[model samples]
Target: MQKQDFYQSLVKQAQALISGERNVIANMANLSALLFTSLEDINWAGFYLVDSPDELVLGPFQGNPACIRIPVGKGVCGTAAHAKETQLVEDVHAFDGHIACDAASNSEIVIPVFKNGEVFAVLDIDSPSLARFDEADRDGLQALVRCFELTLS
Candidate 1:
């Protein structure tokens, strides 16, 4: 499917999921699966939620066993939380202190989630191909994150 069409389908699915009666975790997991399946050349798609002790706890995801704990500013996911912005890293190895949950992940994108203007968590995606993500992905995933945020409250 075209990128735009995929994004629109994602939005529609997210809206329905959020509007349904399932719990947040289920919704998030469904969203992760949707993203993982819709996007091409992706190896990981999931979320890392903030824990009570001010650390990121692994949340719903569709990938291999990943790093269990990530500090507030460590890897791509953590950096997105700390910086409170979306990051599109075309080369994961080139990123200073990149965390290798999966060595095969050559590129990544992390979008920060917010609740009341405070950083809550992140929607992270990883790909095995370099430069797999671009401006269209950044915008589409950001929109996807926004749809997720609406379900939080």
Candidate 2:
């Protein structure tokens, strides 16, 4: 499928999966699994929830075991949460302050998930291929994040 079409379908599927669910953890778990299973070339897909002003605690995930904690502004996931903007890194190795949760992840995309107009968590996806994420991925994933935001609202 074309990238846009694929993302739209994924978003639709995610919406269906969590449509009536109001629990945040349940939504996160399902969304992570949805992304991990639907996306190609990804090694990790999960959440890093805001634990404090400067730290994130790992949440539901699908992949090799990952870092349990990440400080805000420390890595792509943290950076996105801190900045409240998406972090799409084509080369994770070159990003300053990168936290290598998995050595196999060469690229990463982190999207801030907001609640009450503040960052509540982040959706993190890691790929083993350089430049694995593009603008389409960013836009698509941002839409997916919106689905979560709406559900968690």
Query: Which candidate leads in lDDT?
Result: 2
lDDT by residue for model 2 (1-153), tens:
899999999999999999999999999999999999999999999999999998999999999999999999898898898888999999999999999989999999999999999999999999999999999999999999998899867
Error of 2 at 108 (Å): 0.2
Q: Rate residue 153 of model 1 by lDDT.
A: 69
lDDT measured at residue 49 in model 1 versus the true structure, 0 to 100? 91
Give the Cα error of residue 146 in candidate 1, in Å: 0.7
Q: For candidate 1, which ten residues in a row score worst on lDDT?
A: 15-24
Residue 66 in candidate 1 has what lDDT? 93
lDDT of each: 0.87, 0.95
Candidate 1, residues 108-137, lDDT tens digits: the string is 999998878888789999999999999888
In order, how many clashes per candidate? 0, 0
